[model samples]
Target: MLTSAILAETGHAAPTVPGLASVIPFVILLLCIAILPLIHKTSHWWEHNKNKLIVALSLGLVTIAYYQMRGYGIAHGDHATDPGIRTVLTVLDHAILGEFIPFISLLFSLYVISGGIRVKGDIPAHPITNTVFLAIGGLLASFIGTTGASMLLIRPVLRTNSERKHVVHTVIFFIFIVSNIGGCLLPIGDPPLFLGYLKGVPFLWTFKLWKEWAFCLVVLLVIYYAWDTIAYKKESKQDVTLDETRVTPIGIDGKINFLWLAGVVFVTGTMDPTKPFLGTGWTPFPFLRELLQTAFVGLSLVSTGKGVRAANHFSYTAILEVACLFIGIFICMQAPIEILNLKGASLGVDTPYKFFWATGALSSFLDNAPTYVVFFETANALTHEPGPGILQLLSGHFIREDLLIAISLGAVFMGANTYIGNGPNFMVKSIAEHAKIKMPSFFGYMGYSVCILIPVFCAVMFLFL
Candidate 1:
């Protein structure tokens, strides 16, 4: 029965229900994330490390059970391999070495390096100044990741607005612009785009999104300036005064991290799986990139002064929280990815608009990196292209360019729709709340995105998609 179920779900003879049972762990994890923090007021259970560990282990065990029952194993395993032990080993290898290690390593490198660079001094949080800050952050986001840019700028933005009462909108807009929409222009800017790059989309392919970037930036910045100006005026009417002494000339500490930052860029740009490390005699290991990034994290740790991290209030809590939750996410997400690979062409997502919304909607909930891969495969399937190369599909006219564009845009942009839409969104919110800036609840944050970001995306659909 188990063998029949697995074979049917894998599209061997005839399709069964595709074993959606595998996705239950993912849904439970997401529900806990969405609800647990909100109810932390009543039940302190969510606040305990033990509870988080229990949830993570529970979901992990479910994933193992699903894979075991399905007779799944490592990528190259044959049918003769032992299913139970091989399944456990494959899940551990994929989850830890393949996904979790690299993911956490890059994030830790960014966090440690960015945390070392303290922006010394506060610029008054006037509407225009705030707007300029966000603009800079958006541009920086394309260079350093959304996570890097968020960690680098959130503290300074908070400090600048320390005198203001109504600042939640500022952080909300920051998530919209810096953490999500700004990442559309480069593979380095977002995980989804980077996944595309790894799949043979040219590194510069995403630069075509400059128009989408400009559109979203212009609209969001204009609205933010107008809204902030009104809020500032209201606060002024309430007799608020800027503390001149609290203001200092803007500069940066731990400038050495910039060299480390450059190193990160170089590593990401040059690390190719198909390419040899040095010569034909030596091939690159799969974990080589993660190892290089981990070394960079070590450099940042030793190079920066303690004062810089202290000033930034740098702690491992945000990254720790992300690491805990995403393990369950990456594990359980395998089922949906498998289903999509087998059956996506039949899902009525043949058009560019459909691809955009479908990919974007799922990217809003699931980890966007894998979501992009799933939809990328789905789009490729529609073409029945001879090769898996994205560039090949484009150059040969095997796939519609508009369809690719829609998938790329959707996977990168709509990650602002909710806290879980992107990794950095929740990190930014957590950092803000840690600093005593009360961020909106998960659903409340969505309310802001619905009002502000959805219309801008609609304009994108009309003009670009």
Candidate 2:
């Protein structure tokens, strides 16, 4: 393969493929996330971050042991030069350092910084007003990131609608529109696209999917308006009247954090190691981005008053759970992703819609970021050589525009299908549950996704993919 040939020239290490059985731990871990929380006995136990960490690390260790037994175990000498150590380093680099650290760093920065800024008001949670808020969230998701927009908006949204009886649907739609569907336009919008940007795709290229973004948002917004109007009518007359009479002017706490948020956007937008926006690449030192992000995290903490985070009902638990679960998710997923990279071309996923659904279906269960990469390489596999395309990325290996759009939309949009699909979905769920709103169970949440999201995605597949 020319891709491998190019890597050979560049002295790049080829991936060490694990056998099929190795993927079991990955599947088991994901299933635990989905099922354990549903069981009456285990559900309470699963809520603890410590328990989640145990599960994640335990499963992760199983994979490491598998590698050890496979005769690629020993790493005694200098790990930098040894071939045995190369596999360990490359996989770890991809799973932990390359993928997880930068991933969690951005999320941490956004989560911590956004938590500093709180929207203060009890605006009447009229259907139109709620609709407007979601619209704003959609816009903010792309700029500040879905996690940032979700963290910033969920509190005010819940506070505004606190007077209403039926607001669970609002939160559900928030997860769908704000947390997932909204962040499709740019690298900062979602994890998968951001990763694509990092790997080789230009930062600005995703703006090409605006039509798909517009259609999904318009449709979801219309449905939400109609649904919320009905729900509002069902609310007790007293609650509606109370909401109307108690409107307060909205104000922002921690306004300085907006500058910090801009700093985050700027760093992510400009500081690409593979292709720097300003100057020569900085791929040699990968930690530079994480270092800058950490600085911003500290800046945000110092700049914003502690009182503001309290008002926002901020806690580390949400980010901590994400951090813990994802370490395992990234580690366990190596086998499946590698399989996709190798056997992807023979899978009959030759068309755009096939790529859309295949990537999306797996993304709904697995973490969408690596799912995007697997299918991305799969799409790259169809072409024997890099074609003239926008993906002008690593070693000049790129796929066509149509295939890239399919995978991108599939990853970003279908991530709304489940709690674990994208990073912010569970965080939104956690925050909403903490607000005393009873969210649906794991499979229960899927009910909402199945009914509302699937049809819209079908339409997207037909029209766009």
Candidate 3:
């Protein structure tokens, strides 16, 4: 490839292909996956033990950090001589990950929810309330981003069903509908789709996802209704009596900084490759732009500290964990990304369906934003297509709306396929577990997704995407 060829000419050690470089991180990840099940199998250390998992996770993180730091200098060692790493890193930096901001925003919203006041029990339980909340949650996820909506609502959703002995299905359904599948209507709804829009795919182009969104939404709603009905029937059958007198509504205990949280969503959603409203022959406020985003996240965290002994303590934990894990994944995955881009044309994938599933399946685990770009750029680079049309330039001459739609829908919709498919999926599961929801394990989660999401996704691929 040109990158490797250029590296050889630059008098630097040529970069190895990603397939080879990926061995170590993949191995480490596999080991983690294997060990987690063992940890879960032992009765001594329950999966619900957040603090214990935190301790173990912290130790693992320290070790990974040590090795990563040792390799860090060498990561860019050839930068001066060869620009390959720099080129790849420059293109794949934090800004690329920003495509998943909606997912991140979802987490921020969740953190805000955790500090709310504890309501007294004995309140009347209304199934309609759960339905309404989930509906509102889906709408909010689209607008504010999925992560934002999930974080804000998950705690309350859990609290509403907290007393119920059977609620794992509720949390699972939430992750499926609210956390992942709901963000399909607009670019702002999800990061991967947003990245596509920023790269020249139109903002309104995402409406193509409506069909898939409707399908998933209907299926999930039906599942929820059925499960809730059975659970409700059981409660009735058992004649379970709640102490209504003891029930109380929990008010917002901490400072209800709704506006600050809104600011975070705005900055995270609007800051993009498109650089909205950047230039209009008017003086641009570059410094102000940076400040607003910084202040938005900073002020949001600061606001979270007002009622607590330690400020920014809880706010930082989830964000910091996401930061660390994603950082490692991003940095280590660079080689693979570069290679993917370099060899994209030769992959023999040229159909809309192939591109859809190819990009999506990768997006399921890989960072979807970059995955979208790589596939889009690959499709674009397919032909030295003659004329200068934006559509032609983008899709390398065969830029049909249907093709674009497939790519868009696949990248956005299939992201719900696994816990790691999108940022908030795992975060929601983690937080739900933290709230003691008894969520499934990584592979266990996959089983649920495969059985439910896969069939529906294939149906969409056949019918729409």
Q: What's the TM-score of every candidate structure?
A: 0.90, 0.91, 0.74
Clash totals in order: 0, 0, 19
Error of 3 at 285 (Å): 8.0
Q: Over the stretch 278-358, how does candidate 2's per-residue lDDT look in tens digits?
A: 765544345667778889999999988899998888999889999989999988887677677666777899888998999
Candidate 1 on 135-171: residue-level lDDT in tens?
9999989889898899999999998888888899999
lDDT score for residue 157 of model 3: 73
Model 2 lDDT at residue 341? 69
Query: What does the lDDT come to for candidate 3?
Result: 0.59
Off by over 4 Å in 2: 1-19, 71-86, 280-284, 384-395
> Lowest-lDDT window of 10 residues in candidate 1?
1-10
Q: After superposition, how far is residue 146 of candidate 1 from its true place, in Å?
A: 0.9
**Cα displacement (Å) at residue 332, model 2:** 1.3
Q: For candidate 3, lDDT tens digit of each residue in 109-219?
A: 445443322222234345555666677777777776776667666766776665566777777778878877788787767777766765666566677667778877877
Q: lDDT of model 3 at residue 56?
A: 37
User: What does the lDDT come to for candidate 1?
Assistant: 0.78
